[model samples]
Target: MVFSWIRKKAADDQEKLKKGDELVIPNQFVCPISLDLMKDPVSLSSGITYDRDSIESWLDGGNFTCPVTNQVLRSFDQIPNHSLRKMIQDWGVANRSYGVDRIPTPKVPVSGIQVSELLFILEDSVESLNGRRCLELVQKVKKWGGESERNRLCVVANGAITVFSAAFDAFARDDSFETNANLLEEMLSNMNWMFPLSQLHSLDHHHTEAAQARLGSRDSLRCLVWLLKCGDLSAKKDSMIALKELVSSDQKHAEALAAIEEASEVLFRLVKDPVCPAITRSSLMVIFHLVSSPSSSTSMAIRSELVKMGLVSLLLELTVDSERSTSEAALGVFDMLCDCEEGKEEAYRNALTFPVLVKKILRVSELATQFSVSAIWKLGRHEKEREKVNIFLAEALQVGIFQKLVLLLQLGCGSVTKEKATELLKTMNPCRPELECVDSVDFKNLKRSF
Candidate 1:
């Protein structure tokens, strides 16, 4: 009875194909991973079927469980779903007139034996004359690994990070810059993949320490700085991202990065460049992480370089022209810089700093509002400079900064930030009549809060 019903359905499908109608393949026939007809369906220990290539790639990427069931697999073995494959083939045959292509059998996936052999080759290449071969193999692995999460796990499982790190160390040790350039480029490219994967895997402390050590080395630092200056766009972006990851992972790493003389200048140039917004953002992130450290010396070193580089002027420009996130980062960094006297002096010297900071209040994100308020308070608290304070207050009144602060109290802000805003309004008491007369109901309520 079931066989007869199946035959009837097949005949009906063929008739529909003959009439030039589109036949929708059953959802079950589609591979969840690829979202297309499964070429070589296979079942895992968890009883979930997937395209052989997709599942194998997933497993190879270091996943120990099934993608669908999320159940732990007893092993990496996959059994071909021959019955489902036949059904799909039959469907394709019946729909040939409807432009349905036959799903060809897939090739056998990379086996454990092959992975072991590749690892052995990588290990041997460290001291061997097969550096070119080693690079070629690494490139192949990188490309393959990038194709699927499965391949990425396989690469990681095979100790790819350690191999690539060693390769970088080896290339750096060689004095022949011209000779090792290609090799160095390949190693750096591999890092682009390795770093993210390491983070994904939540790599053990030893591996993280090893990576940090390699990146912190003098040779590695010089190479990265050189890459930022001389490498192509992609190389520069990768170097910046790698630096960001290193600093984000550890404060000690950030301190080490800031200690490099070229770090600040190179990052500043990237920020000022208008071509690649991504690189600019990455550069900003690296700077944020550097100054975000608690160490006073680190902040002072970065702040001094930024002040000399005229960071205040650049930040003012970004706040006006760049996106909200960039503006927020600029403000955050600006706020940190203002913690030191040199930073405050530099900011005060920039004519647009106060005006730009005032303009951002209540106009950007909440975080931007907080940073802007803090910055204004920092600048307005010129107790020793009574003359400057009066001059700044007069300027603040003219620019309507006092009016904005009054409105801010009515709008509500964090307690500390609101307190800062309230205090700033009091400091401008000499101009209170000017501030209060700017409006009626709202201005009266703002004064009562003060």
Candidate 2:
């Protein structure tokens, strides 16, 4: 009779659970990233627990910091929280009467030994069967690596780069081989995942040079350019990202890439594409990085092409329409471009350039402000046309450039920037005396120091 009564009570509990009853979950069982009961809980070096898949996705996206603590992760390793997993499973079992499902154990992640063996299979054999197997392994590694930082590091540490490079070289060498665009795209994605920007500076010099050589090859360069023009959206983004990494790692690589005529044109097109803001911003950044090294042959080449491609008008437009980072990148590129005669001519000829420059001062971040001021100073110093200079000065006055400059001085800017601003103010003052009293007190104080 007692047993029957217990069974009846259990049935009643299950019935209530099925009737839209709310279940209270313990806080400890929740993953930080998913905010759900962790089916496969893992702990990061930050000592925070998250669902395995959620945390892995976060790390694989090139983020090296702990999401919760915002601290630099000491390691990319994720240790499985077996105790937490078991506890959650136990809770589910205890609540079975309430219709709660028990959590199943997750499969073990790909190991370094397996990755190394597959890499050997790729490198040591040339049979068609081996090639097929190798491609399969590459895809698996990519999938596993994308799920967790540990797998990514393991794949990279196991010489996956060399394996991918070999495959790319083999395919490029033999046009008759069935070239799988998808496979190539996957390889590029994995390469990007392995070598993010943060890891570039730490690479050995030889490694950087080798990468430059491999990527700068005619066949390799052609493939990348083709991918940009014809590949799927994912392929194009990955190609651009890889190109960015290459160019940012060393000046030699930038020069080599700029030497490719098709590359410059493709980058320009990417900049103009409105469909992807992320791609547009990245494209601008690549161009900025390319032209950053002044007095280099590469810089001269890139600047010439930029002018030929109507970069001035585009940059001016982007400055108005883009967000803060994109605006800053545009201004940064403009600053470099204006250093040369051709770039200055293009900028000065544009009616909007000077006005835009004046308005951006004190209107954006300090970096943007600095670039804008420098651009204006460049125009003012280089303008041999007396009438044009007068017109520019008029525009400057009308746009409250003087007030902003005075405010900039009082607020304190870089020494060189302040000197240039002061020089510009002094130059323009002779033409506009009525505006002299605008910030007379602060202006006098700043002038005395100068």
Candidate 3:
């Protein structure tokens, strides 16, 4: 029975492909420049559809033949868009208003199915839709725009990219890291169609309605999605900064804080975006910076979420870049954090990985010595921490640490008054037995040596 089903499925797939092939391929979908399927189609300022690929091929790669102009398109920029792209843009604008509030609940028309469904289907492969079909459907939905529809399309494209990312990760497990990377690059190239600025006047507009929603509404989910997926590191940082800047006015403080607190959950999700390349890593840094900043008007929800993630150590990691100012600032914050004993404990408890402060100290010995000396001075005399000091010292001594200790003692005593040094020396001397007798001359020489 399974074999028969497989045979039937193969026949159906081939039939569908034949039908797909029979349909007239539009010149609009095909780039005039590369004569390939459009990737990152841009409606240029001149109303022409051109992108990096066209620019490269037509100008630099000597494939300068233009279909419409019948002229050699010397520069990719030369394509005139006086009519073509403007119509698409105008159509998009007109369609956007029609479905602003059309929520795709379970009862909604299947024809009006949104991007989330596409994402869900792809994730489960439930409808047996392949990647090419999935992308085609997304593009189709994008071309037929409503505000809701466009958002849906954007999210679908995002979801498709994620699916590709997952596939790439799986491939990496089979030792195809290079191929996986190439696939990811291709996915990113295709995903450029969902640029936030292209769909709306600004990215903020995309989330404005959702931001206005009551806490935990589906609309809020829209805001969270962009925060997680859309923005680059610099972009995310700027967005957070913009939100924070608004908080000082107090007029929108509560609303902004609420939105950001909701955003924090998304930020947490973003930190785990799997691609830890520089750009994504930088985005994570921006999130940590926001969480660590005292100026941030983040809510309790966000704060608690950060605490759970051991935000302090994460912040420390962000500051590990070669930027001296950043490192010093991070250190200052760390010192302040040390003041909160309970918070420190909580931070350590929740840490994903230990900070390896000792190993780090060894790497940066001068900084480590500064910290260690200060800590030793503070804890060495403390009744509560003395045992810790003894344990630490014993371990150090085992590794021939007496030389370091002697050097430190000399350095520490250099600033001391002679009288104070003498007093310290007296305090440090081991007491002799009262009943023990020695030759007077030998005792005098021993005292001189001491």
Estimated TM-score for each candidate: 0.78, 0.73, 0.27
In model 3, what is the error at residue 413, expressed in angstroms? 22
Instruction: Write down the lDDT of every candidate, Cα atoms only.
Output: 0.75, 0.75, 0.39
Winner by TM-score: 1
Candidate 1 yields a Cα-based lDDT of 0.75
Candidate 1 is scored at a TM of 0.78
Model 3 RMSD, rounded to 1 decimal: 20.8
Per-residue lDDT for 1-450 in model 3, tens only?
A: 664564445434533433432532234545766775343455433345764346544544555454445565444444333343333333333334433222121112123245556556654541342445544544444443333443444454343434433432332243333333333233333334432322333335434323222222333223323434555554344333333322322323333444543455555554444334443343343443443443444533444555565655654564445344334333433433333333344433433212222222222334433433332232223345555534443343333333333433454423332233233224222322222222223112111111
> What tens-digit string does per-residue lDDT give for candidate 2 at 211-292?
5566656666667767887787898888888777777776676776777668788888888765487778778878887887
How far residue 247's Cα lies from its native spot in candidate 2, in Å, is 1.2
In model 3, the Cα lDDT at residue 320 comes to 48
Candidate 1 lDDT at 241 equals 75
**lDDT string, candidate 1, 12-111, tens digits:** 7655445336567677789988888898899888888998877867876888998888899997778887767877888888778778997775544555
The deviation in Å at residue 430 for candidate 2 is: 1.3
Model 2 misses residue 55 by how many Å? 16
Consecutive 10-residue window with the lowest summed lDDT within model 1 = 439-448
